[model samples]
Target: MIKGYKTQIMDYYEKIRYHERKALQERKDNIKREHPEILDLENEIGRLSIKLSMDILRHGNADDVVSKTREAITDLRVQKAELLVAYGYGQDYLSMHYQCSKCNDTGYIGTKRCSCFDRYLVKLYYKSSELAESIKTNNFNTFNLDFYSPRSDGSEKFSPRDNIEQILSYIKNDYIPNFKNHSVNMLFYGDPGTGKTFMTQCIAKELLDKGFLVIYKTSDELNKDLRTITFDNDKALEESLINCDLLIIDDLGAEQITDFSVTNFFTFLNKKLIKNKKMLISTNLLLSDLTKSYTERITSRLFGNFRLQKFYTEDIRIQKKSLRQNRFSEKTILNQ
Candidate 1:
């Protein structure tokens, strides 16, 4: 990926140079054609200087010729400046100008990368993630607790809505204080339709916006990609996953586990734990389900590292439908 980015920058630099050269030549030609009077004055000055030097060389007493040459040079300089002002360029027209002045159209600076190159890498990275919609649609700003019911009359008096709101508040505050560093690994375990994936994506978007490298992948999709890994670059994906600022493993336990997958996952988790990188896991598996499906060792490691947020209640889909119907009925009555 890094090599590809470098090549891309080189290609961009070549294109920029091509266009700038064309523009500079066009500017020079246009000046000579459109301002013929200035060009004529410059040519006359050069001729006079050459003639005066020849005269001095032919006859050693040519002081008057030298004085005339000096006056002609000064007047030509003034004409050149006026011509530059008429055209929208300064007298330094020979200087190469670049759209990206930091790089001088060369997409790199010294041994390091240029600002435009860095921005290109960033854009490429985001494109590879392929989650622009997820980033745009899910964030702290779009998340609203008002959509959830606040009634405390169910079997669990303070409902799932209240529980999730508290979790949201804690997450917001946690990100504010420790987003730059000291972030805790989180395991959002719950039943389906309880907002586990939504919150995970929201957190991913927030971290990504703050310029963190966050890789978000579902277990099933990731497992499919892992199957194609060659003997070489075995560590490439693993390194990216473990070394990124945040790794979000969503829909865990949804993939059919193979030996290669199990081994790779264990290795990934172990390396990330050793490095203390934040890993956020969101799954529909409860602690009991996790212990039964995966080994106790994996479960122990997860519990030891992650702050568990267990979501429990009636499914949110049913609640959303009921709430929509209620709002519709109220609207009809108001119209009547």
Candidate 2:
């Protein structure tokens, strides 16, 4: 999906190997100068290792002889290690280092891509998607329950604070910890500025931090991406949407409701649901109006596959702006 990203990662691995080999050579030169005896022992170890390989190839040699040769080489290696430590150098001082020892700084382990490579790709995705900066301010640690009222209204069973506390508990304690095990998707519907998008962002940050490939797009942004997939035939972008760990679509009804938009929306959601890729959708539209708002096929897939939750609270944007104004007033009074 990203331009020249594979080449960039390959270059990173090449640089790692180059620097490590250079460092190893400097360490070897130091050893050769100060501890020539240790260097001589290392040469002997190399010679014996070559002999062991040759003897293993020689079918004429018995197993006992090969075993004896390996034991002697091991003794010399241990002795050399002891001398190096005694002289204040680490035992591995002459060895080349790897950033990711599993893949030895290469993006792949054998033929398959390594977990470290996935992390790098995720980093690039987050950086490009603007999620890295967004999560810095909107994560779980920055979330505040004080904005929600503790007093219950007659329309709901509990206070906004109580309901949100329950929702947050389920998301943080249960859902997030068992994200991999559970195949459930989520639907967050609420009044605008009632913390629907904020909670969705919180989940995004949590999952992304755990190394999940999370793609966040507003409904309008997704509409444009779908257009690109249709017009440009971007297979990588399509694969990313269909195969990511989680796809978060915010403001479901904000896009222009054309026939094309409705059709593409249903198709994308249906594909993800069928493939078992998790998704979280947040919308300002009422849950009851969903049938009226969307096509029958879209609503059917949503109600069947998604675990729907309704957010309830006064506008958090208003509350936060008010809080900021109060802080400014307090600061001014203090200065006076």
Candidate 3:
């Protein structure tokens, strides 16, 4: 699309230049033939500006020439406005005289990037959304901390809501200055439906906004992909997974642990650690289960590298289901 736009922009620029040149010559010709005493300051300003620019280009020290060029351009602009009014054209006619007024149709702005270059960056970011989609589109704004209950009911004493809030605050503040400069690695371990995945997704969303590139993938999907390829594709996925700006491997212990997968997972983890790339992982299994499922090296690296947060809760799905049934029964009786 950008290439196509570049071609179109060039064509549009050529057309606009042709029209401006024709207008200028027609103005000069009319003055020479008809309005000889009208004092054609516009053409004189144009010639002075050309001379100034040439002088700057040749000398390579353009302080005076640049100042004079600015004055000449300003004078010609004022003259053009007066001429347009005299000839019954409006102020809007100036827009059609140049395709890009900022760069004056040269396609570059001063010494830095142009608006077109910025647009190309925006396009590149939009195209690079395969990983970003998992992060940006799912953020803390979409996370409902309210869903977490403050108490663990009459059974045992634990506070999931308080735990979640602490986790949330830690993630938000930790990323402010330090994580922005140096990335942080984390591990989320817990029972199923206890908000491990939820918290990891929230972090992914936050770090992405802080300008860290993040890739969120389940261990199951990653292992499957690795098995399908032999060499090149395998290397590419390995590199991306290990060395991305941030990586969140969700559902860690869920994949069937074959020898190839166990080796690959450890290798990926070790490489990320070596590079200082941050890794956040979530697992349904405890440390003991993890050790049994994966190798001792993988577990050791995980414990050594990541700030571990273990989630504890009765599955919220079950609680919500019970609540719904009781609510419906009450509503039916009230209606009766």
Pick the lDDT winner: 2
Which candidate order results from sorting by lDDT in descending order? 2, 1, 3
Runs in model 1 deviating more than 4 A are 1-118, 128-130, 151-158, 230-239, 323-336
Worst 10 residues of 2 by lDDT: 1-10
Q: Over the stretch 26-69, how does candidate 2's per-residue lDDT look in tens digits?
A: 99999999999999989999999998988888844677778888
Higher lDDT: candidate 1 or 3?
A: 1
Report model 3's TM-score to 2 decimal places: 0.60
Quote each prediction's TM-score: 0.65, 0.80, 0.60
Top model number, TM-score: 2
lDDT of 1 by residue, 1-336 (tens): 222445666787798899989988787677687876766776777787788778778766558777666777888778777777777778767346788888887766897666676555556666666566776776777775654557655666577678888788888887535776785899999889777887887887776766776778898866755554435465555555666678788988998876677766776678789899988898998789988777777888899999999766566778789989999999999999
lDDT of each: 0.75, 0.88, 0.69
lDDT tens readout by residue for model 3, 1-336: 112334444565566678887876675565566544334665666577788778788766557767767777787778777766787756444343555577665456777545653343333443454545654655678776666778867553558788787777887777534774775688889889887887777776665565555666788877775664334455545655665567778899888888888987776677778889887889989889999988888889988888898787778678768889999999999999
Of the two candidates 1 and 2, the one with more favorable lDDT, higher being better, is 2
Residue runs of model 3 more than 4 Å from their true location after superposition? 1-138, 145-147, 152-158, 227-230, 233-236
